[model samples]
Target: MAVHSLLLGVVQGATEFLPVSSSGHLALAQWLLGFDEAPLPFDLVLHMATMGATVLYFWRDIVDLVLEWLGGFVSARGRWSEGWRYGWAVAAGTVVTAFPALGLKPLVERMIHLPWAVGLALVLTASLLFAAGRLPRRGGQVVLSSGFFVGLAQGLAVIPGLSRSGATIVTGLATGLKSEEAFRFSFLLSVPAICGATFLELRSVGSWGDFTAALPSGWLVGAMAAFATGYFSLVLLRRVVTLGRWRGFSLYCLLLGLGTLALSVVRG
Candidate 1:
């Protein structure tokens, strides 16, 4: 069980930020390992770890945006600040994301048990990544409309094999945002989605005691492993996006998606 947790943690972290789908990888990993879905508590912990990694990676931006946004209430100049606009963009994105996400909950849950569907979704992700690489820089700012469209992409990515980061980043690029800005905004937008999901998981967990009973190590292994790898993956992905090196990830997703589909057929 510990070994399984460790391996899944590694997969979760490694794929989470890499334009590859973490949910896809984790679901496929669990299926291949012949395990039921991970315990609810540990799932929460792993997600929180991802959230922590994202927060740590972009702490400065987050802090500055937050402070600047907050200052807007007291000063007109602050209200027109970049941070204030960026902050509203984030909020707008989150709100738009919630609609499709909630509406598609049933389908997303069904994707969990359907590896072939997940594989197809990964192919979609690869297409998005490949296109993101070729898009011209629109040099657009992260305004409400751009953010809203990106959020729609994020919402659709709730499907198992679809990469949330891939979807949002590509959508941002398609909307003419700079590559670096797309990358940064995508992750920042994820913060709220992650928090909302984590909150729901916590509410569903019932008791903390159930978590301890399931883990001899008290969920520390998954959390630590995920956080460590997730942080570095963020660092690596930032470089990859800024350098226009997205083709490699696009190819990887394509191959993985095809392979997963092939394996499912054989297993049947």
Candidate 2:
């Protein structure tokens, strides 16, 4: 594998869990490296790898939610269970956040090709991250309406520079959810959304083999690095959220956005 492939994996792993946008970072990285080829299926592999880790790490929570939903369907007192309500909140949030991105897929794809557009969006993402510090904190449980609002933020995050996690976390904070709750829910919600994206890519490309034929070793290295790095990133992010230290991430995004913009202008 090439050195850049390893770097790509690290970037994917590091940013995938952070409020910083992984896709946005990858886009800027690819541009900086001047890679002229398509990086789709391979990109999907890295994303899928992270998605798997997230699911594995949260398997119990996911399983409990499923069981609760199933039992509620079969039992009379199902509606009274906190598990059932939490499950619905998860599902509702997923639908609210992901649906608009699906609807705007074409538009996002088109805009991402324009570096200037991506640069502008990255600036906006930086602004949101910065604003997170000013948002009021919610006590605990996330309200149902908050889901839609967060989803709307996530929808805008389809742009290359915007961090899905950052957008969602900021939205959650703005809606009054505590940082830890906001972070946890953001990760949990990412499972389905990332899977849906990977699946859509695979469907269009036919299979992993097609992508592998061009860059097998690079893809494998990227995936492994992504998994290892992402696992640790998730753990660290949880701790930071618990400590209410999200302001640093805001600064990081702002600096990164500015740096990318500077590079773009220099190259032109």
Candidate 3:
């Protein structure tokens, strides 16, 4: 169980930001390991660990954005700060993402049990990346509408094969933001989303105490590995996005999707 957790942790952290579907990859890993599905407690732990990595990576921006946004209520100068606008944009995006994502939660879990469905979703993710790669890059800032659209993409990305970062970054680009800005905002936007997910997972577990007591083997090592690998994955993804090299990720997703589908066929 520990070994499985370690591998899944690495998979979760590594792909969570790389425009590849982390959930899909996890499903493949679990399938290969002879597990029917990942246990909920373990899933929650992995999510929190990876979320921690994202928070640490962007801690500075997060602090500034939060402080500036709060300060705006009392200071006129604070209202005009970039952080204020970006903060609201993130909030708006989170609201927009809530509807579809919440509505599809049940379906998303069901899809996790279907490997072929994950493969198809991966194909969809590849297409989205390909389209975004073709769009012209711009230096525009994120606004309410941009947040809304990207949120919509993120909402739909709750599906196992869909890539949250890929979908949001693509939508961010289509909305005219520059590659780096889009990359930054995409992860910034993820903070609340992950928090919300963690909350839900906690609720589903009934209580943190009960949840912790029954934690599966290897959780600590798995979580630590996840955080470590996830941090580096963020660094690698930053370079990839800044270089406008999404087509490479696109190709990777395409091949992986096809291969997953092929394996499904052969096994069935």
TM-scores of all models?
Answer: 0.95, 0.89, 0.95
Model 3 Cα shift for residue 233 (angstroms): 0.6
Q: Candidate 2, clashing residue pairs? A: 138-176
Tell me the tens digit of each residue's lDDT in model 2 across 1-268: 5666777788889988887887777666667666543367777878888887798777887787778767899897886675676667667777876778888789777766656667777778778877776676667665566667776777778878788888887777777888877886777777877777777777887655776676645677878888989998889888776676777887777777777777778877
Q: How close is candidate 1 to the true structure, as a TM-score?
A: 0.95
Which residue pairs clash in candidate 1? none
Residues 110-201 of candidate 1 have per-residue lDDT tens digits of 88888999999999988988988788866778888877999898888888899988889889888889888999999999999889878876
| Tens-digit lDDT track of model 3 for 14-41 | 9988899898887777776675466788
**Each candidate: RMSD to true structure?**
1.4, 2.2, 1.4
Question: lDDT of all predictions, in order shown?
Answer: 0.86, 0.75, 0.88
lDDT minimum window of 10 residues, candidate 2: 29-38
Model 1 residue 134 lDDT score: 88
Minimum summed lDDT over a 10-residue window in model 1 is located at: 210-219
Ranking by lDDT: 3, 1, 2
Position 217, candidate 1: lDDT: 51
| Pairwise lDDT winner, candidates 2 and 3 | 3
